[model samples]
Target: MTPPISRSHPGLRAVFELAEFLDHGQKLPEQSRSLLAQALQECIADGFDTSLFTALGITQWGGVPAVKKIGLLRRDRVLRRLRSRIPEWASLSPNAAAKEMSASFRRYETTRWPRERHSAKGPAAQPNSIWWGLLRSELGVPGEKRLAQILKAEIQDGFEFPKGPATVAGTGEHPENTGTNIR
Candidate 1:
Protein backbone atom coordinates (compact mmCIF):
# COMPACT_ATOMS: atom_id res chain seq x y z
CA MET A 1 0.00 0.00 0.00
CA THR A 2 1.20 3.51 -0.75
CA PRO A 3 1.45 6.14 1.92
CA PRO A 4 -0.97 9.03 1.59
CA ILE A 5 0.26 12.51 0.80
CA SER A 6 0.38 14.81 3.80
CA ARG A 7 -0.52 18.34 2.75
CA SER A 8 -0.40 20.02 6.16
CA HIS A 9 2.80 21.89 7.06
CA PRO A 10 4.68 21.59 10.37
CA GLY A 11 3.98 25.22 11.18
CA LEU A 12 0.30 24.50 10.71
CA ARG A 13 0.44 21.53 13.06
CA ALA A 14 0.38 23.72 16.13
CA VAL A 15 -2.46 25.68 14.66
CA PHE A 16 -4.28 22.45 13.92
CA GLU A 17 -3.61 21.24 17.43
CA LEU A 18 -5.20 24.38 18.76
CA ALA A 19 -8.07 23.92 16.33
CA GLU A 20 -8.58 20.35 17.46
CA PHE A 21 -8.72 21.42 21.06
CA LEU A 22 -11.26 24.04 20.15
CA ASP A 23 -13.30 21.59 18.11
CA HIS A 24 -13.36 19.06 20.91
CA GLY A 25 -14.07 21.66 23.56
CA GLN A 26 -10.78 20.81 25.24
CA LYS A 27 -8.32 23.26 26.75
CA LEU A 28 -4.89 23.56 25.23
CA PRO A 29 -1.71 23.15 27.26
CA GLU A 30 -1.16 26.45 29.01
CA GLN A 31 2.23 27.26 27.54
CA SER A 32 1.34 26.41 23.96
CA ARG A 33 -2.01 28.13 24.15
CA SER A 34 -0.40 31.15 25.71
CA LEU A 35 2.10 31.47 22.89
CA LEU A 36 -0.66 31.22 20.35
CA ALA A 37 -2.58 33.85 22.29
CA GLN A 38 0.40 36.18 22.19
CA ALA A 39 0.84 35.65 18.48
CA LEU A 40 -2.85 36.27 17.99
CA GLN A 41 -2.70 39.51 19.97
CA GLU A 42 0.18 40.73 17.89
CA CYS A 43 -1.72 39.87 14.74
CA ILE A 44 -4.72 41.85 15.90
CA ALA A 45 -2.59 44.73 17.09
CA ASP A 46 -1.07 44.73 13.64
CA GLY A 47 -4.63 45.05 12.30
CA PHE A 48 -5.82 41.48 11.96
CA ASP A 49 -9.14 40.34 13.34
CA THR A 50 -10.48 37.38 15.30
CA SER A 51 -11.33 35.94 11.93
CA LEU A 52 -7.62 35.92 11.19
CA PHE A 53 -7.17 33.79 14.30
CA THR A 54 -9.77 31.50 12.81
CA ALA A 55 -8.08 31.78 9.43
CA LEU A 56 -4.82 30.71 10.98
CA GLY A 57 -7.11 28.13 12.55
CA ILE A 58 -7.25 28.81 16.31
CA THR A 59 -10.23 30.00 18.30
CA GLN A 60 -11.18 27.94 21.29
CA TRP A 61 -8.55 27.10 23.98
CA GLY A 62 -6.37 30.13 23.24
CA GLY A 63 -5.64 33.42 24.99
CA VAL A 64 -8.54 35.67 25.92
CA PRO A 65 -6.71 38.90 25.17
CA ALA A 66 -5.98 37.71 21.66
CA VAL A 67 -9.57 36.78 20.95
CA LYS A 68 -10.94 40.02 22.41
CA LYS A 69 -8.37 42.05 20.54
CA ILE A 70 -9.28 40.31 17.33
CA GLY A 71 -12.93 41.12 17.86
CA LEU A 72 -12.22 44.74 18.71
CA LEU A 73 -9.91 45.25 15.74
CA ARG A 74 -12.47 43.75 13.40
CA ARG A 75 -15.17 45.96 14.86
CA ASP A 76 -13.01 49.00 14.41
CA ARG A 77 -12.21 48.23 10.80
CA VAL A 78 -15.82 47.43 9.93
CA LEU A 79 -17.14 50.60 11.51
CA ARG A 80 -14.57 52.62 9.64
CA ARG A 81 -15.55 50.96 6.39
CA LEU A 82 -19.26 51.37 7.03
CA ARG A 83 -19.03 55.00 8.06
CA SER A 84 -16.99 55.72 5.00
CA ARG A 85 -19.17 53.85 2.55
CA ILE A 86 -22.63 54.57 3.94
CA PRO A 87 -24.14 57.98 3.54
CA GLU A 88 -25.80 59.52 6.56
CA TRP A 89 -29.51 60.28 6.56
CA ALA A 90 -28.09 63.19 8.52
CA SER A 91 -30.85 64.40 10.84
CA LEU A 92 -33.05 61.29 10.58
CA SER A 93 -30.42 58.58 11.02
CA PRO A 94 -30.43 56.83 14.37
CA ASN A 95 -27.52 57.60 16.70
CA ALA A 96 -24.57 55.28 16.10
CA ALA A 97 -26.89 53.03 14.14
CA ALA A 98 -24.37 52.55 11.37
CA LYS A 99 -21.64 51.69 13.82
CA GLU A 100 -23.88 49.19 15.59
CA MET A 101 -24.85 47.55 12.31
CA SER A 102 -21.25 47.44 11.16
CA ALA A 103 -20.13 45.91 14.44
CA SER A 104 -22.73 43.19 14.13
CA PHE A 105 -21.67 42.43 10.58
CA ARG A 106 -18.02 42.32 11.59
CA ARG A 107 -18.78 39.85 14.32
CA TYR A 108 -20.75 37.69 11.97
CA GLU A 109 -18.08 37.76 9.25
CA THR A 110 -15.21 37.05 11.63
CA THR A 111 -17.08 34.21 13.27
CA ARG A 112 -17.70 32.62 9.87
CA TRP A 113 -14.00 32.16 9.00
CA PRO A 114 -13.65 28.81 10.74
CA ARG A 115 -16.03 26.97 8.47
CA GLU A 116 -15.57 29.17 5.46
CA ARG A 117 -11.80 28.90 5.50
CA HIS A 118 -12.06 25.16 5.93
CA SER A 119 -14.09 24.94 2.80
CA ALA A 120 -12.16 27.57 0.94
CA LYS A 121 -8.79 25.99 1.60
CA GLY A 122 -10.00 22.82 -0.10
CA PRO A 123 -8.89 19.25 0.64
CA ALA A 124 -5.28 20.31 0.24
CA ALA A 125 -5.47 22.12 3.54
CA GLN A 126 -6.95 19.19 5.44
CA PRO A 127 -4.73 17.06 7.63
CA ASN A 128 -3.25 13.89 6.16
CA SER A 129 -4.81 11.58 8.73
CA ILE A 130 -8.31 12.25 7.45
CA TRP A 131 -9.56 9.24 5.54
CA TRP A 132 -9.50 10.06 1.86
CA GLY A 133 -11.80 7.18 1.07
CA LEU A 134 -14.63 8.73 3.03
CA LEU A 135 -13.86 12.34 2.17
CA ARG A 136 -13.54 11.67 -1.55
CA SER A 137 -16.78 9.81 -1.54
CA GLU A 138 -18.51 12.69 0.15
CA LEU A 139 -16.90 15.56 -1.79
CA GLY A 140 -16.23 13.99 -5.20
CA VAL A 141 -12.68 14.26 -6.56
CA PRO A 142 -9.54 15.32 -4.70
CA GLY A 143 -8.60 18.42 -6.69
CA GLU A 144 -8.84 22.08 -5.70
CA LYS A 145 -11.58 22.98 -8.16
CA ARG A 146 -13.74 20.12 -6.99
CA LEU A 147 -13.25 21.15 -3.40
CA ALA A 148 -14.18 24.77 -4.18
CA GLN A 149 -17.30 23.73 -6.07
CA ILE A 150 -18.32 21.50 -3.21
CA LEU A 151 -17.86 24.32 -0.74
CA LYS A 152 -19.75 26.79 -2.89
CA ALA A 153 -22.65 24.42 -3.18
CA GLU A 154 -22.62 23.83 0.54
CA ILE A 155 -22.48 27.53 1.31
CA GLN A 156 -25.33 28.34 -0.99
CA ASP A 157 -27.66 25.61 0.19
CA GLY A 158 -26.55 25.35 3.79
CA PHE A 159 -27.35 28.81 5.12
CA GLU A 160 -30.29 31.15 4.90
CA PHE A 161 -30.75 34.83 5.58
CA PRO A 162 -32.75 35.67 8.67
CA LYS A 163 -35.99 37.55 8.44
CA GLY A 164 -35.76 41.19 9.55
CA PRO A 165 -32.01 40.93 10.00
CA ALA A 166 -28.78 40.09 8.17
CA THR A 167 -28.11 37.16 10.49
CA VAL A 168 -28.16 33.64 9.21
CA ALA A 169 -30.42 31.04 10.81
CA GLY A 170 -29.43 27.47 11.85
CA THR A 171 -26.24 25.77 12.97
CA GLY A 172 -23.49 24.68 10.57
CA GLU A 173 -23.73 20.97 11.25
CA HIS A 174 -25.08 19.83 7.92
CA PRO A 175 -23.12 20.24 4.69
CA GLU A 176 -25.90 22.48 3.54
CA ASN A 177 -25.90 24.48 6.77
CA THR A 178 -23.05 26.97 6.76
CA GLY A 179 -24.24 29.03 9.73
CA THR A 180 -22.23 28.57 12.92
CA ASN A 181 -22.83 29.75 16.49
CA ILE A 182 -19.25 29.62 17.78
CA ARG A 183 -18.69 33.33 17.49
Candidate 2:
Protein backbone atom coordinates (compact mmCIF):
# COMPACT_ATOMS: atom_id res chain seq x y z
CA MET A 1 0.00 0.00 0.00
CA THR A 2 1.11 3.53 -0.67
CA PRO A 3 2.31 5.41 2.36
CA PRO A 4 0.24 8.26 3.77
CA ILE A 5 1.08 11.54 2.11
CA SER A 6 2.94 14.30 3.92
CA ARG A 7 2.21 17.95 3.14
CA SER A 8 5.84 18.89 3.63
CA HIS A 9 6.60 19.47 -0.01
CA PRO A 10 8.46 22.69 -0.82
CA GLY A 11 5.67 24.04 -3.00
CA LEU A 12 3.08 23.30 -0.35
CA ARG A 13 5.22 24.92 2.30
CA ALA A 14 5.54 28.05 0.18
CA VAL A 15 1.80 28.22 -0.31
CA PHE A 16 1.21 27.72 3.41
CA GLU A 17 3.71 30.40 4.32
CA LEU A 18 2.02 32.81 1.97
CA ALA A 19 -1.37 31.92 3.38
CA GLU A 20 -0.21 32.32 6.95
CA PHE A 21 1.27 35.71 6.18
CA LEU A 22 -1.98 36.83 4.63
CA ASP A 23 -4.00 35.38 7.48
CA HIS A 24 -1.94 37.22 10.03
CA GLY A 25 -2.63 40.60 8.39
CA GLN A 26 0.96 40.91 7.24
CA LYS A 27 1.83 41.80 3.69
CA LEU A 28 4.29 39.66 1.78
CA PRO A 29 7.39 41.60 0.87
CA GLU A 30 7.08 42.78 -2.73
CA GLN A 31 10.00 40.76 -4.07
CA SER A 32 8.91 37.46 -2.51
CA ARG A 33 5.30 37.97 -3.58
CA SER A 34 6.31 38.74 -7.12
CA LEU A 35 8.50 35.65 -7.26
CA LEU A 36 5.57 33.51 -6.14
CA ALA A 37 3.14 35.12 -8.55
CA GLN A 38 5.50 34.61 -11.44
CA ALA A 39 6.05 31.02 -10.46
CA LEU A 40 2.28 30.45 -10.51
CA GLN A 41 1.97 32.07 -13.91
CA GLU A 42 4.78 29.94 -15.32
CA CYS A 43 2.98 26.84 -14.11
CA ILE A 44 -0.25 28.01 -15.73
CA ALA A 45 1.45 28.87 -18.99
CA ASP A 46 3.01 25.42 -19.02
CA GLY A 47 -0.49 23.87 -18.84
CA PHE A 48 -0.27 22.95 -15.19
CA ASP A 49 -3.61 23.31 -13.43
CA THR A 50 -3.15 25.81 -10.61
CA SER A 51 -5.75 27.43 -8.37
CA LEU A 52 -4.16 29.90 -6.01
CA PHE A 53 -7.32 30.28 -4.01
CA THR A 54 -7.60 26.58 -3.45
CA ALA A 55 -3.91 26.23 -2.74
CA LEU A 56 -4.20 28.95 -0.09
CA GLY A 57 -7.38 27.35 1.33
CA ILE A 58 -9.63 30.21 0.38
CA THR A 59 -13.11 29.44 -0.95
CA GLN A 60 -13.83 30.85 -4.39
CA TRP A 61 -17.06 32.52 -5.23
CA GLY A 62 -17.82 32.44 -8.90
CA GLY A 63 -14.16 32.24 -9.90
CA VAL A 64 -12.16 34.39 -7.51
CA PRO A 65 -12.03 34.23 -3.80
CA ALA A 66 -13.22 37.33 -1.94
CA VAL A 67 -11.16 36.85 1.17
CA LYS A 68 -7.87 37.32 -0.62
CA LYS A 69 -9.10 39.54 -3.40
CA ILE A 70 -6.22 41.98 -3.07
CA GLY A 71 -3.62 39.28 -3.38
CA LEU A 72 -5.50 37.83 -6.34
CA LEU A 73 -5.52 41.22 -7.96
CA ARG A 74 -1.78 41.51 -7.47
CA ARG A 75 -1.32 38.05 -8.90
CA ASP A 76 -3.36 38.98 -11.94
CA ARG A 77 -1.22 42.06 -12.46
CA VAL A 78 1.92 39.94 -12.21
CA LEU A 79 0.53 37.39 -14.68
CA ARG A 80 -0.16 40.09 -17.24
CA ARG A 81 3.34 41.45 -16.74
CA LEU A 82 4.82 37.97 -17.22
CA ARG A 83 2.91 37.37 -20.45
CA SER A 84 3.92 40.69 -21.89
CA ARG A 85 7.52 40.51 -20.68
CA ILE A 86 8.35 36.98 -21.74
CA PRO A 87 7.33 36.43 -25.35
CA GLU A 88 8.22 32.73 -25.49
CA TRP A 89 7.01 31.82 -22.02
CA ALA A 90 3.57 30.74 -23.15
CA SER A 91 5.03 28.08 -25.42
CA LEU A 92 7.09 26.40 -22.71
CA SER A 93 6.01 22.87 -21.73
CA PRO A 94 4.81 22.11 -18.21
CA ASN A 95 7.82 20.00 -17.39
CA ALA A 96 10.18 22.66 -18.62
CA ALA A 97 8.41 25.42 -16.73
CA ALA A 98 8.30 23.34 -13.56
CA LYS A 99 11.98 22.67 -13.82
CA GLU A 100 12.71 26.35 -14.28
CA MET A 101 10.51 27.34 -11.35
CA SER A 102 12.15 24.77 -9.11
CA ALA A 103 15.54 26.23 -9.93
CA SER A 104 14.36 29.78 -9.29
CA PHE A 105 12.99 28.83 -5.88
CA ARG A 106 16.19 27.10 -4.92
CA ARG A 107 18.26 30.11 -5.88
CA TYR A 108 15.93 32.56 -4.15
CA GLU A 109 15.98 30.53 -0.95
CA THR A 110 19.74 30.35 -0.84
CA THR A 111 20.08 34.06 -1.39
CA ARG A 112 17.31 35.07 0.98
CA TRP A 113 18.58 32.86 3.77
CA PRO A 114 22.26 32.18 3.56
CA ARG A 115 23.47 29.44 5.85
CA GLU A 116 25.51 30.50 8.84
CA ARG A 117 28.86 28.74 9.01
CA HIS A 118 30.73 28.15 12.23
CA SER A 119 34.49 28.15 12.57
CA ALA A 120 36.75 27.01 15.37
CA LYS A 121 37.07 30.64 16.44
CA GLY A 122 33.35 31.40 16.19
CA PRO A 123 30.55 31.90 13.67
CA ALA A 124 31.97 33.45 10.52
CA ALA A 125 30.22 36.69 9.70
CA GLN A 126 30.01 37.71 6.09
CA PRO A 127 27.89 40.04 4.03
CA ASN A 128 25.18 38.37 1.94
CA SER A 129 27.27 37.76 -1.14
CA ILE A 130 24.79 35.27 -2.54
CA TRP A 131 21.98 37.82 -2.56
CA TRP A 132 24.20 40.45 -4.12
CA GLY A 133 25.38 38.02 -6.76
CA LEU A 134 21.80 37.09 -7.62
CA LEU A 135 20.93 40.76 -7.89
CA ARG A 136 23.79 41.31 -10.29
CA SER A 137 22.78 38.27 -12.33
CA GLU A 138 19.26 39.64 -12.64
CA LEU A 139 20.66 42.58 -14.61
CA GLY A 140 21.57 40.22 -17.47
CA VAL A 141 18.00 39.00 -17.86
CA PRO A 142 15.56 41.84 -17.76
CA GLY A 143 12.06 41.39 -16.33
CA GLU A 144 10.64 37.87 -16.07
CA LYS A 145 13.47 36.08 -17.85
CA ARG A 146 15.58 36.36 -14.74
CA LEU A 147 12.97 34.50 -12.76
CA ALA A 148 12.76 31.83 -15.48
CA GLN A 149 16.52 31.37 -15.51
CA ILE A 150 16.62 30.95 -11.75
CA LEU A 151 13.78 28.44 -11.83
CA LYS A 152 15.37 26.44 -14.64
CA ALA A 153 18.51 26.11 -12.55
CA GLU A 154 16.53 24.50 -9.72
CA ILE A 155 17.21 20.95 -10.91
CA GLN A 156 20.84 21.38 -11.76
CA ASP A 157 23.84 20.11 -9.74
CA GLY A 158 22.48 16.60 -9.22
CA PHE A 159 19.05 17.79 -8.15
CA GLU A 160 16.36 15.40 -9.38
CA PHE A 161 13.62 16.73 -11.58
CA PRO A 162 10.05 15.94 -10.69
CA LYS A 163 9.06 12.59 -12.18
CA GLY A 164 5.54 13.74 -13.04
CA PRO A 165 3.36 16.85 -13.02
CA ALA A 166 3.93 19.27 -10.17
CA THR A 167 2.17 18.32 -6.95
CA VAL A 168 2.54 18.81 -3.19
CA ALA A 169 4.03 15.38 -2.76
CA GLY A 170 7.21 14.39 -1.00
CA THR A 171 10.33 14.35 -3.14
CA GLY A 172 11.51 10.79 -2.67
CA GLU A 173 15.10 9.75 -2.26
CA HIS A 174 17.37 10.51 -5.20
CA PRO A 175 20.61 8.89 -4.17
CA GLU A 176 22.29 9.87 -7.38
CA ASN A 177 21.39 13.54 -6.92
CA THR A 178 22.24 13.96 -3.26
CA GLY A 179 25.21 16.30 -2.77
CA THR A 180 26.39 19.52 -1.11
CA ASN A 181 27.16 21.35 -4.32
CA ILE A 182 24.76 24.06 -5.46
CA ARG A 183 24.35 24.40 -9.19
Candidate 3:
Protein backbone atom coordinates (compact mmCIF):
# COMPACT_ATOMS: atom_id res chain seq x y z
CA MET A 1 0.00 0.00 0.00
CA THR A 2 1.14 3.58 -0.62
CA PRO A 3 1.96 5.70 2.36
CA PRO A 4 -0.07 8.84 2.92
CA ILE A 5 1.29 12.10 1.56
CA SER A 6 2.89 14.31 4.16
CA ARG A 7 1.67 17.88 4.66
CA SER A 8 4.78 19.21 3.00
CA HIS A 9 4.27 17.13 -0.12
CA PRO A 10 2.49 19.90 -2.02
CA GLY A 11 5.04 22.55 -1.17
CA LEU A 12 7.95 20.25 -1.92
CA ARG A 13 6.33 19.22 -5.16
CA ALA A 14 5.74 22.86 -6.10
CA VAL A 15 9.38 23.67 -5.52
CA PHE A 16 10.53 21.26 -8.20
CA GLU A 17 7.70 22.06 -10.56
CA LEU A 18 8.47 25.75 -10.44
CA ALA A 19 12.17 25.12 -10.84
CA GLU A 20 11.59 23.00 -13.92
CA PHE A 21 9.28 25.61 -15.36
CA LEU A 22 11.78 28.39 -14.84
CA ASP A 23 14.64 26.28 -16.13
CA HIS A 24 12.92 25.81 -19.45
CA GLY A 25 13.24 29.60 -19.88
CA GLN A 26 10.27 29.48 -22.21
CA LYS A 27 7.01 31.32 -21.76
CA LEU A 28 5.13 30.26 -18.67
CA PRO A 29 2.29 28.10 -19.91
CA GLU A 30 -0.98 29.26 -18.36
CA GLN A 31 -2.22 25.83 -17.32
CA SER A 32 1.03 24.67 -15.70
CA ARG A 33 1.59 28.14 -14.26
CA SER A 34 -1.78 28.21 -12.57
CA LEU A 35 -1.30 24.73 -11.20
CA LEU A 36 2.11 25.65 -9.80
CA ALA A 37 0.79 28.89 -8.35
CA GLN A 38 -1.95 27.04 -6.53
CA ALA A 39 0.46 24.48 -5.18
CA LEU A 40 2.83 27.15 -3.87
CA GLN A 41 0.08 29.18 -2.19
CA GLU A 42 -1.52 26.08 -0.77
CA CYS A 43 1.80 25.04 0.62
CA ILE A 44 1.84 28.19 2.73
CA ALA A 45 -1.76 27.87 3.86
CA ASP A 46 -1.61 24.15 4.51
CA GLY A 47 1.56 23.79 6.56
CA PHE A 48 5.23 24.50 7.10
CA ASP A 49 7.09 23.83 3.90
CA THR A 50 10.73 24.05 4.90
CA SER A 51 11.31 21.09 2.64
CA LEU A 52 10.31 23.27 -0.30
CA PHE A 53 13.15 25.73 0.28
CA THR A 54 15.57 22.90 0.92
CA ALA A 55 14.90 21.54 -2.53
CA LEU A 56 15.71 24.96 -4.03
CA GLY A 57 19.18 24.71 -2.46
CA ILE A 58 19.46 28.44 -1.63
CA THR A 59 21.31 27.88 1.62
CA GLN A 60 23.90 30.60 1.24
CA TRP A 61 22.04 33.01 3.55
CA GLY A 62 21.74 30.42 6.26
CA GLY A 63 18.19 29.76 7.50
CA VAL A 64 16.11 32.66 6.27
CA PRO A 65 12.71 31.33 5.28
CA ALA A 66 12.43 31.55 1.51
CA VAL A 67 10.16 34.41 0.40
CA LYS A 68 9.43 35.65 -3.13
CA LYS A 69 9.62 39.46 -2.96
CA ILE A 70 12.91 39.50 -1.17
CA GLY A 71 14.20 36.85 -3.55
CA LEU A 72 13.23 38.97 -6.55
CA LEU A 73 14.85 42.17 -5.29
CA ARG A 74 18.01 41.24 -7.06
CA ARG A 75 19.91 44.54 -7.53
CA ASP A 76 16.79 46.61 -7.09
CA ARG A 77 17.15 50.07 -5.56
CA VAL A 78 14.62 49.36 -2.87
CA LEU A 79 16.29 46.16 -1.81
CA ARG A 80 19.68 47.76 -1.92
CA ARG A 81 18.52 50.58 0.31
CA LEU A 82 17.01 48.21 2.82
CA ARG A 83 20.03 45.96 2.69
CA SER A 84 22.28 48.95 3.20
CA ARG A 85 20.67 49.40 6.58
CA ILE A 86 21.70 45.95 7.71
CA PRO A 87 24.23 47.49 10.04
CA GLU A 88 21.61 49.66 11.68
CA TRP A 89 18.84 47.10 11.87
CA ALA A 90 21.08 44.31 12.98
CA SER A 91 22.05 46.40 16.00
CA LEU A 92 18.58 45.96 17.48
CA SER A 93 17.72 42.89 19.52
CA PRO A 94 18.62 39.85 17.48
CA ASN A 95 15.23 38.25 17.99
CA ALA A 96 13.38 41.42 17.03
CA ALA A 97 15.61 42.00 14.02
CA ALA A 98 15.15 38.48 12.80
CA LYS A 99 11.40 38.69 13.23
CA GLU A 100 11.24 41.82 11.13
CA MET A 101 13.57 40.37 8.54
CA SER A 102 11.37 37.33 8.14
CA ALA A 103 8.33 39.55 7.74
CA SER A 104 10.06 41.63 5.11
CA PHE A 105 11.11 38.55 3.25
CA ARG A 106 7.54 37.21 3.25
CA ARG A 107 5.75 40.45 2.45
CA TYR A 108 5.56 40.08 -1.33
CA GLU A 109 5.80 36.35 -1.93
CA THR A 110 2.12 35.87 -2.54
CA THR A 111 1.53 38.98 -4.59
CA ARG A 112 4.35 38.72 -7.12
CA TRP A 113 3.99 36.67 -10.27
CA PRO A 114 5.45 33.21 -9.85
CA ARG A 115 7.78 33.63 -12.80
CA GLU A 116 9.14 37.02 -11.73
CA ARG A 117 9.45 35.90 -8.15
CA HIS A 118 11.96 33.25 -9.17
CA SER A 119 13.85 35.49 -11.62
CA ALA A 120 17.34 36.59 -10.47
CA LYS A 121 21.07 36.33 -11.16
CA GLY A 122 23.85 34.36 -9.50
CA PRO A 123 25.55 37.33 -7.84
CA ALA A 124 22.33 39.01 -6.74
CA ALA A 125 20.88 36.01 -4.90
CA GLN A 126 19.07 37.41 -1.87
CA PRO A 127 17.85 34.78 0.57
CA ASN A 128 21.12 33.86 2.21
CA SER A 129 23.31 36.86 1.59
CA ILE A 130 20.72 39.29 2.93
CA TRP A 131 20.38 37.28 6.12
CA TRP A 132 24.12 37.15 6.52
CA GLY A 133 24.59 40.82 5.69
CA LEU A 134 22.09 41.84 8.31
CA LEU A 135 23.79 39.82 10.99
CA ARG A 136 27.29 40.80 9.97
CA SER A 137 26.24 44.43 9.79
CA GLU A 138 25.20 44.52 13.42
CA LEU A 139 26.07 42.76 16.63
CA GLY A 140 23.32 40.22 16.03
CA VAL A 141 24.08 36.81 14.62
CA PRO A 142 22.17 35.10 11.87
CA GLY A 143 20.59 31.78 12.84
CA GLU A 144 23.15 29.81 10.89
CA LYS A 145 26.11 31.48 12.59
CA ARG A 146 24.60 31.46 16.05
CA LEU A 147 24.05 27.76 15.70
CA ALA A 148 27.50 27.35 14.26
CA GLN A 149 29.31 29.25 17.03
CA ILE A 150 28.21 26.44 19.30
CA LEU A 151 29.19 23.71 16.88
CA LYS A 152 31.31 22.07 19.53
CA ALA A 153 28.02 21.52 21.34
CA GLU A 154 25.87 20.97 18.19
CA ILE A 155 25.81 21.59 14.42
CA GLN A 156 23.80 22.60 11.22
CA ASP A 157 21.55 24.17 7.13
CA GLY A 158 19.06 27.31 2.66
CA PHE A 159 16.12 29.58 -0.17
CA GLU A 160 15.02 31.21 -3.75
CA PHE A 161 17.74 31.38 -6.40
CA PRO A 162 17.25 31.39 -10.18
CA LYS A 163 20.24 29.55 -11.59
CA GLY A 164 19.25 26.27 -10.05
CA PRO A 165 20.31 22.64 -10.74
CA ALA A 166 20.65 23.02 -14.51
CA THR A 167 22.76 26.18 -14.60
CA VAL A 168 25.06 24.94 -11.88
CA ALA A 169 25.92 21.84 -13.85
CA GLY A 170 26.52 23.96 -16.93
CA THR A 171 29.02 26.25 -15.19
CA GLY A 172 31.68 23.51 -15.47
CA GLU A 173 33.73 25.47 -12.96
CA HIS A 174 33.67 22.51 -10.57
CA PRO A 175 34.34 18.89 -11.43
CA GLU A 176 30.89 18.24 -9.95
CA ASN A 177 28.17 20.75 -9.07
CA THR A 178 27.31 19.15 -5.77
CA GLY A 179 26.88 22.02 -3.32
CA THR A 180 23.40 23.09 -2.26
CA ASN A 181 23.87 26.88 -2.73
CA ILE A 182 22.46 27.20 -6.27
CA ARG A 183 23.97 30.61 -7.09
- For every candidate structure, what is the RMSD over all alpha carbons to the true structure, in angstroms? 20.6, 18.6, 15.1
| Higher-lDDT candidate of 1 and 3 | 3
Q: Model 1, range 1-183, lDDT digits (tens) per residue?
A: 223212242223444456446444556667657667777777778777545445444453334433443333222332232333444522223334433433443443356433444442222221111112122223212233333232223222111222211111123131113222112
Each candidate structure's TM-score, on Cα atoms with residue i matched to residue i, is 0.26, 0.23, 0.24
TM-score-wise, the better of 1 and 3 is 1
Clashing pairs in 3: 58-159, 59-158, 61-128
The regions of model 3 sitting more than 4 angstroms off are: 1-85, 113-115, 118-183
Model 3, span 5-123: residue lDDT tens:
23234443354446555555545546546656554565576574533344333322323334432222221221223333566543545445445555554442333323343333222
Q: Which has the higher lDDT value, candidate number 1 or candidate number 2? A: 2
Higher-scoring candidate on TM-score, 2 or 3:
3
Lowest lDDT block of 10, candidate 2: 174-183
Which structure is stronger by TM-score: 1 or 2?
A: 1
In order of TM-score, best first, we have: 1, 3, 2
Best by TM-score: 1
